[model samples]
Target: MQKRQSAKLQREKGRARRRRRRIRNVGAISRSEVEASTVADPLCLNNGIYLLVRSYNYINILYSTISLLFSVFLFNRPSLSLFILKGKNYFCIVLAAAMSPWRIMMGMIKEKSIRIEKARHVFEAKEEYFIQNGAMLLEKQITCNQGRDTEPIKIFSAKEIQQATNNYDPNLILGSDIATVYKGMLDEREVAIKVKGPTIYCSTELMVDFFLQQVTIKQLISHKNVVRLYGCCLETKIPMLVLEFIRNGTLSDHLHGQRNKIPCQISWLDRVRIATETSYALCHHPTEMFLRHNNLVDYFVLKMRENCILQIVDDVVLSQGSNEDIQAFAELALRCLNNKGDERPSMREVTIELRRILQLVRSRDSKLSNEIGLALT
Candidate 1:
């Protein structure tokens, strides 16, 4: 019985010690888990999330800032506007991604609306100018003079002429005087565009009336020597005329103006032919008008009066022209340049005389060529 009680006491002591150790181990484990959770659970997770959110915000801000700067810079420069418009597709994608899609869309819509409004205003202004420039009256007269069967003068749009002339670049200018002439391609055909320049001390109404009359007369006056009037643009304050493209320069430019290294010189035969053709064109003009006086006419009168007209002839004409033919031409020119309109030779008589001179020159040339051929033989 003593041995049994001793053994039982020992066992009880062992059980108490094991239980204390288990309790201590469990408390240590619980404390360690609490400390680990405090360090790693909410704090680490929150800090990592905060860093990620901050980086994302920075990226968004950087993107938006870059987009805004590009937009402002591109919009400010007029020269770069074309580039921006061309690359707008790429820019739109970047802008939409960097900024709010809704805001970007709204801004684009507003810009589009503004452009449309501006275009509408421009169109209305062009229409008003077209009406104010006597386009209606011109159209009525064209219809009346040129029957429905004949094609009337084409009325070109302002945009068409502008595009044709590359906005009237100075480099493409052919001539400038009462009107500026531009060389351009219209409807796949070479055309000369004549835009009247602003004149000083000119009444607007008188100018408009004069321009209207000139256009009407040109439509009625169709001769081989006269440049064909193709069309006109009335969409501007001053109407623009479209004439046939003459590759060669004008007679005045060839005769008196400084030549631009042209290879061909006008021969005496060509001179007489030109005079005949000019008289043919003048025959179409009103016959009852007074003779137009200019410096050339005055010089001719002075030279003829002095009997020194041959001295004033071009070197080419002096070399090839016959004295008799020159005398006849001088007499005809004097008659045409008479100060009194009624005393001057009518255009019909002038044309006939010029033709006779041209025929005589051709006959003389043919005889000379025949004689030269005989000598060669």
Candidate 2:
């Protein structure tokens, strides 16, 4: 009788505890949803409207006065109010056009533009970095929090990045070069972060240059076959480059037994696409920064090729295609492999050639749209 009573009491206690826990969970979820909903409400958009109106008023007043003044001198008669009104209207039209959805940046204000300024890479010890401005500067170098001008547009606090990367856990690794990389998630977007400490041979400038070179290449070229460059992080002097995390493992690993299962066979056409894309990047960007998959190439190539040699072909995203297309791609790859950079064709030439090949391949496949270019070639 005593044992039965004891067992019954324990069961009742457990049931009561579970009920209370369920109630607590419901309350927590309700609170979170309320907070999220409040933050996302469109009612807060009045501030943006207020700023936009202020901007319009300022611009109209300045431009209208100038126009009125010009009309008085040029026309030899001053109908100042009418002419000023016309000028204001024109200014308003231009402003509206600029703010239109079709406009690229939606006439974002200085504050908004700065906020939209994406983080390419954030480095620690950013004191060492300086933006080496070449010809194509979409953005100028910005001062880091240290009040020192470092290369890269801006620097990020290390603590902030640490929070984003979850303290750089091993699982965050996307790919490793000389350092481990982490796939970071911030503002709900995926970012590949490569973190490195100050190295003996590499100064901060050199490191920033390395990532900038990568960005430079991406800026010059874009294709489905190449891994895309998002931006880099130089918040710290010891920087991390954030890139598009290719969820698929490297071609070497997939083709070789390095990843898992039997070494997968890469079709000749797919190899051709990869080759073409690699050549395209080189011809367009032209970098001296040669990368070696030192830790990975040989094992991967053995499974993919009988000769077991992997060199420049290792860092590529292989995709499916045809034999003739493959041949043209191979030629381009050979040009990329050319020891002399000067020997490589200009990007303009390479693009023209690729288009021709694509056209030829399209004709063969019947997938080529006649509208793509009757006059284009």
For all candidates, what are the clash counts?
Answer: 0, 23
The digit string of per-residue lDDT tens for model 2 on 1-377 reads 99999999999999999986654333111223323333454442222211111124555446544543343344332121221122222223232111122122433565576655533223322433433223212342221123443223233455657877999887876656555678787557876766773243467567655555555545444556566655555445445556567766678765664556766666543444554565565564644444445455445445334532233343332234454565565566445444455775666677667766766655654543455565576
lDDT of 1 by residue, 1-377 (tens): 99999999999999999986654333111223323433445443232211111122344445434443443333321111111111212222121212233445667999999999999999998999898776655575776576534335888999999999999999999887766899999989999998875453367666556566667767776767678888888887777888899987788667654365654466789889988987887796766666465878888889999999988886667788899999999998788677777888788999999999999999999999999999999
Give the RMSD in angstroms, all C-alphas superposed, for model 1. Answer: 17.5
Candidate 1 wrongly placed segments (more than 4 Å): 1-123, 134-148, 198-229, 252-258, 291-294
In candidate 2, residue 132 scores what lDDT? 28
As for candidate 1, its clashing pairs are: none
Question: After superposition, which runs of candidate 2 have C-alpha atoms over 4 Å from their true positions?
Answer: 1-155, 188-190, 197-204, 212-235, 242-328, 367-377
lDDT of 1: 0.69
Provide the TM-score for each candidate, comma-separated: 0.61, 0.39
In candidate 1, position 166 carries an lDDT of 99
